[model samples]
Target chain A: MSVGYVSVQWNRHKRIYDACVAGGIVLYLGVFFAAGKALYTGRNAISGEILAMRALATCAFLMLNVILCIGPLARLDRRFLPLLYNRRHLGVATFLVALAHAAIAIGFYHGFGNVNPFVALLTSNTNFTSLSAFPYQTLGLFALLILFLMAATSHDFWLKNLGAPAWKRLHMLVYIAYGLLVMHVALGILQTQRSPWLASLVGVGVVIVATLHLIAGQRERRHDERGSQLSPRAGEEWVDVGAVDDIADQRGSTVTVGAGERIALFRYNGCVSATTNVCAHQGGPLGEGKIIDGCITCPWHGWQYRPADGRSPPPFAEKIHTYRVRVVGRRIQVDPTPLPPGTAVEPARVEEVQSA
Target chain B: MPGLILLGASIYATVGTLFGAGFVLRGVERVDPAALGAPWTFRILILPGVIALWPLMAWRWWCAPRTRGAA
Candidate 1:
């Protein structure tokens, strides 16, 4: 959205969102540290640093769970959309907490070793084969690395440079990171601690995350497979996009052609043109966007493109795959063959030839 | 940087095919023919994570009846 790079395009909403996140972290640590201490009083004495690390670890894990849940929750209900807007913020916080956890663990567990601490971490943790005695620190380290990559590249600059597909692919490592963290906790603590409450909490988090993803994925698959194919196909085929009236003025409708990228057919100014549903910026759904000022504005980032040529207006040279569309009777048919990135084509106008 | 990413993507695409035929049959869109047919790089670049996290993407794709801000 920004023409130039700024550290962060912070707004009142972002400020409030980050504040709540900070407050939540503080509150959770305060409560958990106090409660954990009281509960474990009769057992072997636990040091404050270790307890603090554990608290941060748990918080980061919880925060990640919340972050992952937001995507699915938003899809299930519109109310969760606000959380999605600031998800990257939540991700950065999670990384900080995770980093803190690793720092404390490093200084405590590996700091005293004569062989460089980093070297000792790998050398000391030799039990990689055993399930019960696995080196959970290694798992944690891998998870932290993934988190670091995601957090570091969270900015729009990285997104723009890397391109949407690449950026999304990189960030998708979060799920792998999640899986690793779950193992980090389960094998690391549950194997020895045998704390039913902690086990239950981790179990709950996994169940919630896994269940929501499944439900959401199933819903999406059902929808795409429901009636027709929308995206373009191999060897070029004509697909029914839907009725002309189905698309409102300055609006686009998506129709699945078969198995490929989705195509968006836009109706504007008594004419219709079709383009790839995928937006160049962040792969936002173009079909979901609206035409304003005679340009299609992407819903995700508001990147505007001319309806006639599928090209973003001046100063922004983004282009999308445009399709040839024609109207037959009342039904609209789209040629799924995508033109070059920015090919200009005459729009198929919905003209009325009235007998005078 | 993109070239390096492409190498990584190739590795991912290979693994995706070796272990993802069932996944593709199971409806993994990242490695579909449409995605892989052209340069094959797009599928390679996108399939790694798509195969890794198809559930979330699928949900994101179709969970909503109408996309927000749609006219």
Candidate 2:
């Protein structure tokens, strides 16, 4: 197997992605229209209709948060990566529905009459005098503002313009929005002490979901750190394998050569290559994914990298740290020094193995 | 409950129209509100405004394909 023999293509599924976004928009608009009608009618009390409307709004927000989280989490698990790749539309749709929720809350409950809608929203039901006069509406307003920013910049154009680091930092505001929303519901709706059971249920649901994410994220971070430490140090000589056939195709076989780092060997064509098993995208075990047409596609997000160079294809354009390799006798050898991206190396030539 | 249901239905309808327009802009099939028994004024007039620029948006997306070597 020769390293130069393999080439990978990186592309997205635009059709399905577009369809998912379109579907989400349809659902969002439907909810927005429903909320609009309620606002126009000037009904403020938490009737069944209003409650139902609020519930729908809550569901939409929850879904949007999930979409937001999926992008990062998918790096850890390819199965989950699809959720991230197509999550923008979901976020935008959620924002639109949330806007409707806010509009109804403001228009029907705090109609612009004697007091400004903003003032009324913050001032309504001051029975809980002990709490800060910092109206619950302020929290909701802030959360809505964050959501607005997130939705506005959900497009790739904004991402490209802002740059990934800046865009990612801006998007992190979702956590702040999430916190504000929790407080908004607690201080405003929950404090009214009406529908305690329903409020408690919502509270519990949010806590459980948040806790699950926190725990999973922490565990993944720890695993990534451990994998990073295990990576080969620079300038170490690789051990040799007898032949390329010694490595499995599209699968990783753990191998340790004398006085060198342990590496995952992959055979594409007749050539043998090595990389740390942990995926750079999110610490997924690279050894688990199959070789497809000369590239190793991450099982999580379909992020494809050439086995020879560990360079992700276009559109993603990320290169993982790669080790050097050599073949001596029937065994394979590797160098611990990680070659920078676009560096050229000698190709491996081995006889192709017959399928079992 | 019925009152609430009616309110919910109405709100859903307005939101649906806006959402539908967004989808239409994305190039999905346009939803016919009349089929859902909505008022013609809402289905035809208000809804179209929400989606007035959608056709152009759809055209843009269709024109610039993101995936390489796509038909």
In terms of TM-score, the best-performing candidate is 1
User: What are the per-residue Cα lDDT tens digits for candidate 1 across A1-356?
Assistant: 53444456678888999999999999999998998788777666677998998899999999999999998887676577678777888998999999999999988988986755556666676778989888888889889989987876676645654567888999999999999999999997756685688888999999999999999888767767853436435565666768888888889877667666678888888888889988887776688677999998876546789988999898767898898888877678788778998998788888644579
Can you write out model 1's per-residue Cα lDDT over B1-71, one digit (the tens) per residue? 43455467567657645554443333323312222122333234334444444444456435433423232
Model 1 stretches with alpha carbons more than 4 Å out: A37-46, A75-79, A113-115, A226-238, A245-252, A267-272, A291-295, A327-330, A345-356, B1-71
Candidate that would win on lDDT: 1
Candidate 1 overall lDDT versus native: 0.76
Query: What is every candidate's alpha-carbon RMSD to the true fold?
Result: 13.4, 12.7
In candidate 2, how many Å is residue A31 off? 11
- Off-target runs (Cα >4 Å) in candidate 2 are A1-53, A68-78, A114-116, A119-129, A132-134, A225-248, A251-267, A272-290, A298-305, A310-322, A326-336, A347-356, B1-71
Q: Cα deviation in Å at residue B19, candidate 1?
A: 38
Model 1, C-alpha of A277: deviation from truth (Å): 1.3
lDDT of 2 by residue, A97-186 (tens): 778778877887788679766666656755435564346766777898788778765543333334567777888898888888777767
